[model samples]
Target: MTNLLRWTTPDLALTFVLDDGPVRLIAVREASQPRGGEPDPSQPLVEVAAVGHGHSSNRHAGTVLGRQLRYARHDETETTLRIVQEELTTGLRVTSVFEARAGVRAWTEASIIGPGSLELTNLSSLVIGLASIDAELYSAANSWMAENRWSKRVLRDVLADIVRDPHHHVANSRHAVTGTNSWSTGETLPVGVLVDRSTPYALGWQIEHNGPWHYEFGENRRGGYLLLSGPTDHEHQWSVEITAGKPFTTVPVSLVVGTDVDSVFAALTRQRRAIRTRRPIDDRMPVVFNDFMNTLRGDPTTEKLLPLIDAAAEVGADYFCVDAGWYAEGDWWNTVGAWEPSTTRFPNGLAEVINRIHQHRMVPGIWLEPEVIGVRSPIADELPDDAFLTRHGKRVAENGRYLLDLRSPAARKHLDTTVDRLVDEFGIGFFKFDNNTMTGPGTDKGGTSLGHGLLEHNRALLSWLDAIQERHPDLLIENCASGAMRMDYAMLSRLHLQSTSDQEHPLLYAPISAAAPAAVLPEQAGNWAYPITGTTREEFTFALVNGIPGRLYLSGHLNRMTPAELDLVRSALTAHRAVLDDLHTLVPAWPLGLPMWTDDWIALALNGVDVSYLTLWHRAPGPSTITLPIPRSKIAPHFPTDLGDWTYAWNDDALVINANTPEPAARVLRLE
Candidate 1:
């Protein structure tokens, strides 16, 4: 068979013939880059190594990572990549061209950004931002929310499943097939629009479930020599494997979008939003309140906990969910019906402490590990035989806890009764769900097929969610599966927030804070408020206040604080409340991580009305004047528009905002 490719523009462009097994590419720089293709009828661009799978038990599986490329300078108004592939139906050449919007430049040792290096970029003009890596390609919908009344469990389970299997369906994620463009006048569905531009230049990496439905045919596996876009500051991370017998060379391909890729994506995020999808969030503070008695008693005074909680409240935290380890070791480990206050930590009893929190004018919340019971505890002995999840007639043991397989109706009923008890007993506003991973998938009850045990487990958890939400309508749940393991939109609808990444260093949360806006809800984004060491609280506060619209909880004990510093945190939090209370509309929180410094971090908030941006810097740069250009269109021309006899101000084209502050201040500017 003739090579599928023909040289077009020498190596600058290639034309591919669509028939069968192998395709060819013609290169532009044959001399500078010596690829295997020689001076023939068509000099080859680069010969990509191939493999022939001798059999079909699904063996030879791999992926392509994004490539780091530097192009020769050209005097062109636009940068583009053209993709050409064939349509399976008609064997016609499908072509598409993608225009560049944002990209980056950085210094490299050997010109290849070494293993897992940073300095990433994407074309700056994104029409919409998504939350998390929940691409439709990877997620599948078993029930339509409108028809099934959309249970929180199903949504969360699907998302959790998707997160667990992140890359398995990249090429065929359901979301990938969703509409990505506007209508052709009065066209019916969005599928008709892809007639022409569905070319091979389609991104090589797929984050969706494309090949098989079930995980059995290697369906749920993810990882490859892949390419990732919208990762690491807008850059694509390409991974290509080099092996023996197939000496690695170069290959020519293009990244083609149908010019309207951004517009189509924006429409999907806005008009075509699926309710069961993950949320695009506003950032919030992560308050790590302790649940263990010994941990809180370490502070010696429950009242000392008051100051920290008070600090969080002053910063406008919506609800503070106390974390694990609160009950007495004997009481917490085994008791479900006998959940009494830890006498040592709360000598005054639980009600009094909760009342004190009420006086502080903040919501009180707590954590629970209901699915497990200490082996020594009486409850474990009391539970029915089916209440526990066991494999091969034995329970999975870790650190001396008997795991309750949530699959059982009795197990869920027990948890449901406890959720009711917590809210009824303590007036708890938030519940932070934490676990390592999961026990076994579940039983063979619901038409259980082998290797799909989690099917029943996930279904059981969703069943429990239905019961819990019925008792608690506005119950705010936080998904904390060791930091973002359970982050999925299915849970987002029921859960108020999420704690991303078990890692809590302020710098570590930057990406979570950055990417969350595109997917999770504003309040759900876990903006961890870590103890600042060298950085000014003002800078830290600035970053926190502007970056996230979440809660304010502290970690690592800054028990003693200077009056000035406390006030700075208080002031920053106060600013957060004013915005939260008024949240006219969340335009979008944009990211700015330039000057590439992690020693100091920052997150920005934008108010299109004020036509200004609120900047939060984590560390004070040694005194220097930094001039940032904010858009002039964001400002209002009129000093104050007269409404009858009253005067009011609005930002318009004429306004500009700027600020100069002493080390620790959260400053607001009306573009001067």
Candidate 2:
């Protein structure tokens, strides 16, 4: 006999199929949509793999344990459900938990109920059959400077039909996106979207892990399934020994269903806000001026900062951050972790610059890489080898620095002391925490596997962030791993801001800024807008436009700007502040469908109740006109307020814009 179970949230519906054999998740769709028939029977609710006992006949499926587990029981609450299954031969117990929100947040846990030890190589956090086999897949590729480069691919094109007969064979191949090492988003975002080609139905998911993660979609005998997981034995050298009394849990991931791409992303935006730890500082969404991008460039001195401080304050910056080189006397690359002000660089002291920032009615902030210690630093010698990540009794060193294992009390204490001293001595209110090193697999310091060891350290890092935030409730921290590499909810949930990129060129940053909202919340994406002193008026405005839609991370040598140019900078800030007023309530839409790196024109719309804010950028050097498909509404100039060489008109539901400038330019428009 077959048993069917169904669960519904306000927006999503999940259907499960249970038989005397293994359990399967067959359908996931909008609550209003009808549940379909049994999908691929091999679509297990949770996939697992053990050391000696692996897959039976489907080892070619890239999985080892999905078919061996059988249904045990299930329990449900008003908003949460837990389904338990067991591998009777090995006494392995698995529980799949789901919490209903606007969408569904789910994860899985595994434990052994008997005496025999089980070493796990693979365990999935989520495994469910997608609604359709044919869909448009959306994923992103990330890097140091160029982040959020999204690409669209048809599911069939990527995962070919290798099945000879639909009733006889299933394809073992999979289309996968994997992020290895410590930077969760170093290679690609932990987020993805799928929109059915024939219908408006769509699905989106995000893996909330700060370290390595793996997500793959593959077709079985009938349909397709998505599997999300953390470090695996094949991918990240991660495995754990599970005995009778020990249990292992995979990282948490969230899934949401919507109608179209925009609706799916909007639901994700709402889900991100729901999980974020609310703070007053984050709510205010203050404008920050960091002297790193194109101005100070990690060589800040008292002389270089005083003028910048005044300029940032005069242009309405709420915070002034002295990024990098603050604690170094000279070449600080291999001499970090002391966390003391450089006496030679500042002459008087770093406090002099911090105090000057305070005198200008702005919060003082400093940069620090809390997770790394310079190899040549004395502190490296003071801290025991156990305080850092290690493998085979040797420290894991990369790029002239050692990655701190936050699991160590000594390491956490060192960071606590550094942060406390900076706050107490310099009156710092914000911190820009950067991680520049990528620790390969992880440490085998303990008897655990390298992957398991790294997972523990990753959890320890999050706990440390929580502890410090509790101690300093008002302190704000910005998450930057070489810039947007660690851009995941695992960190963004706690940190106040995320530096979108380290890209210096304004034209290059346009696409990064426009496409960032697809993966990150607008309020948290800290895009850099550095208008050079000698650039043309159009060029300066183009730079500032990159920052307006999101949190305006202001930079540049504003003190040396001409009077007219200075006013323009101030004007950009004023325009940004207006956007901040409704930013938290707005949902983003890309009329241009997620900018391409080489796209000549880009548009981002933040939709609100009564008004919609639009940012239009034309990067080509010539006269051009593009029509944006927006409903006809009363439109007006917003940013420069002068329209310069731009003209606009309305054609039915489309808004037409002509950029007559021979140089690159951009503008912010409002529609009501």
Candidate 3:
């Protein structure tokens, strides 16, 4: 047997077998890879002689379903793998899986979920040979899909800033350098910003020990597929549905960096290990509140005097939200760069209002689209030539504001400065990052664009988020790309919550588009109640309690409330706090409708107190049937979770119920 080159991370490991009969690989380590040592030439990476066999003629692994991956596989064999050893040198780290089946590609298998899935997959087909790989040559761009949007000049403009300055500050800020507008350049230079030999690299990127940065690692999805890929076309995708009074759910990123591969694998071995399956830091029901945006910018006022949020909160709301114009006296849509107090109305500054709300015994929350900048702002003018992210020598635009480029160290630095001032100094508790832009811009090549660099920018942004999280371990970040387009596993890993959309009118979300967070992400228990125009204020209060299976959220302007509405809102919050104490886990059950287009969304079954509750939604609404998978914990002896029908519903997903409307609904189907 030839000596295998074994490599590992905290959790997985692989070894390459050199043979004529097909390149073979084995999973030798399911535990953390060697922490700090040379690759032990003594052991096999895994305990398999399985050959890497695949359909000779297959397309690349599609970004999602219909698309193809870099590699393809035939049903080889199923062998379990466990981590045997892992080592990390100052410049290198290695991991080995001892018992893994032969040649089951790391990301190619279904074992990985959520952010881990994206991280593990290098391309559609190829899993790297070790824990880490560096690239002397690399491409930092979106994919082919992006080439059309941003030209080369815009990308060049961006690279100039990223290289010269790499941080964004609240004080040292620029409106043109945030969010999806993280534009970059093409007239390339050697990217040599390494300390010692250790540097950060996403999985699947090929690396050589020595060389200038000039390697190409193919097809890396920042998270998983694109949410809003080509203009929302004719997929006519249905909004996710749940049982009438039933609820539907989806995932968000939740991970705990374990101490070793064994510990990490051990976390995975748990039955609840899925994409969005980690434990929630909080387990309280969200309270109902309202924001008053009566077409403040000439959109349309939510009817009803004073609105329902205050009334909802006074009675029982846990969250109170203030929308866009609250801080803007005029058409401040152009005032995003300077996140300051609106001296005209909010005279005492936001703190006074927050203090009052806290005194009212309510959790104070504020909203911000942190990665966006308006055309007219001090940031654009003050920022030097080497600041904002640009593509083809121009700023990227969304809604009307230019998306900020987070890749710039200066951009990150500026972001930290502003955020620290606003959050740390201002004492704000929550953040809602809204993206009103389209998912534009991809990668770049030479002095032009090949459309794949967008992912690079996003990955860099994620890196920043990771750094930011390290700063304010408990700070809450909300993901809002129009609604669902940007809500992928990558950003989810760090965000504590999300605001479903900017269109706070509950009515707008009625037939629920997949864009609605409540339809997909259960963790983001958010609801947009028009100031007035809701079920009785009590019903509004009820809505708040009902939205989040484990927390509370509301969107209404507080200052616009009447005394009566205030009392009503306060009372509802009290009621929700009581039901929140009983949640331990969340499980997905059958959704309300049949799967639609590309979405197979369903319900989230949560363990509250002693019983489990299902919040459901389906892509297509109908009298259709569904068979859900029950966990081993809920199974009868040894039956697979997808067995038995217990009708309208079908095993652990066994409870049968009538079809509810095709919109998002919450059902209290109790489980033992």
Candidate 4:
């Protein structure tokens, strides 16, 4: 007879089969739902692939070593569970740990004693067999200025049905999504959702790593399986030689279950909040005016900034950030590293401009790319060879910049001295840390694999960020990589805000802003709202509305705008501050499904306790009226207060918006 072991949380339940063979994780479902039938025996709790030993049957599943391991012991607590398995021959032990937080998080740990050596290529963080094969996949493609472009596809469309023969052999091919290099979201997001077509069952997961990660949905003999991992030798050239005393641990991942896309994303939003470090700056959600998007565009001089600083203060901005070029004398792109303020750009001195921002009762912030030292930078030659990432005794150079190895004491000291001197010299409270280059496969430093070496550098970078935050408790930092390339939990969980995109056009920016909440928290999504001085009223409001829903990242030339335009900007900030009152408790919902890049009509709603807020965008001229499936409530214009040409009413519990404007337009409505 087969023995069964079960664990239950308030919202989720897991069932495992403890047999003579390897421990099999059979079912994972809602606690209130019933276990349908017998557990599937093909699903192993842990899957590992090494250099010497491969799989027993298929290249993807049925690992021989994984099947040979047997359960040894288990332990559980109010919010954590640990299961241990051992292979008697190699004396290798694997421990699978699960934690119950806002959602379920899991990881794997391995150690060996008598085994001479094992070079591991692949190690799974979590694997579970699905109940059915009929499911839809939801994933997003990310890029420089265009981020979070999500698309949905049927499972059969990607995972082919090849079980036509009498043998019923499972295919090894998988619908995989992988991310490489230093930018976690440079190619694809580290999160996805699998929703069952026939039932309401939906599963969502996010791999929490600052480096490479892999996840796949494929089939085995019994049914479909979802595998989540960090890095693999085949994909990322990452491998670790595990000796007798040296053990390895996989990166962590979080899993959540819900009914549909909205619910699943809501749970994910909560999980993001649960993992984030609590800081007073994040809670305040202050309005930051960055003079880069459409105004200075990396050319900030004392003469150009004094007037903008006055305009930002007049409009009630809490933080004024002088973005790129502030520290550049001339042609500073490839000569960046010693972050001293440019004497030529500021004429009177950068401190005079920084002090002017302080005189206006706003925190002064500046931009810095701390990870890379330009090829021409003197610091690049000043630091020792070991201070930078090197392969074959040569430094790794990409896009005219040399990557810094934070693990080196020299590199850390250089960064520490630069940051401390700037903070003390100017009373700087904010930093927009930008990364523009990518490390191809990492560095093979210290006789480690390139992937493992990059992994160490990633962790070391996080440690450095932690140290800086500890030393400067009141300082706030923004995580940026060109745009949203590094927009993952590993950075979001620690940083104060995220730059959603560097897209300049407001019309093109609406879709990104609407879909960003699915990946980033509402208060942390730093959406840029740069209202041009010469645009029409509708065009100007369209840009301002883009920033009102998330972190109102104000930009554009307020000094050049007419008095009427500046009033509109002030009104948008007022509406954003009101939304921040309930932003933490509110969850995001798409009245229209996940937006398309060129969708004529888009709707994003932030559902709250007593009152909710909704933003509607009519991007094209053809669609005069669009119906939105939202709760029926009294609606009032939150921003501008003047409805201009747009009008709305309730049909049952759905919203019907009539775009009376002839041109493109957008608006934020308060629903109560």
Worst 10 residues of 3 by lDDT: 224-233
Per residue, candidate 4 scores C-alpha lDDT tens digits across 1-672 of 567888887767888888888887777777788766744747788888888777643334567678788999999987888999988776778899988877888999988868487888778898877766689999999998899999999987887788646667767768889999999999899999999998788999999999999988787666778888888887898988886689898989998889999999998988888889977756767899999999999998889999999999999999999999998877888899999998888788888999999999999999999999999999998999999999999999998999999999999999999999989999999999999999889989999889999988999999999999999989999999998999998888899999999999999999999999988999899999999999999999999999988888999999998999988988898899999898888889998999999899998998887988898889997449888888778779997687888877879877888999889999999889
lDDT of 1: 0.37
Please identify model 4 stretches exceeding 4 Å from their true place. 34-41, 56-59, 164-166
**Predicted candidate 1 versus true structure: per-residue lDDT over 544-658, tens digit per residue:** 4433344433443434556665555555555545545433234334334211224243444444444433443434433323333334433221211111121223344222222
lDDT of 4: 0.88
Give the poorly placed runs of model 1, Cα more than 4 Å off: 1-303, 306-320, 330-339, 440-451, 530-559, 581-584, 587-630, 633-672
Which 10 successive residues of model 1 have the least lDDT summed? 179-188
| Lowest lDDT 10-residue stretch of candidate 4 | 55-64
By TM-score, is 2 or 3 better?
Answer: 2
Residue 14 error, candidate 2, Å: 1.2
TM-scores, each model vs. reference: 0.52, 0.97, 0.52, 0.98
User: What lDDT score belongs to each candidate, Candidate 1 first?
Assistant: 0.37, 0.89, 0.36, 0.88
Instruction: Count clashing residue pairs per candidate.
Output: 84, 0, 173, 0
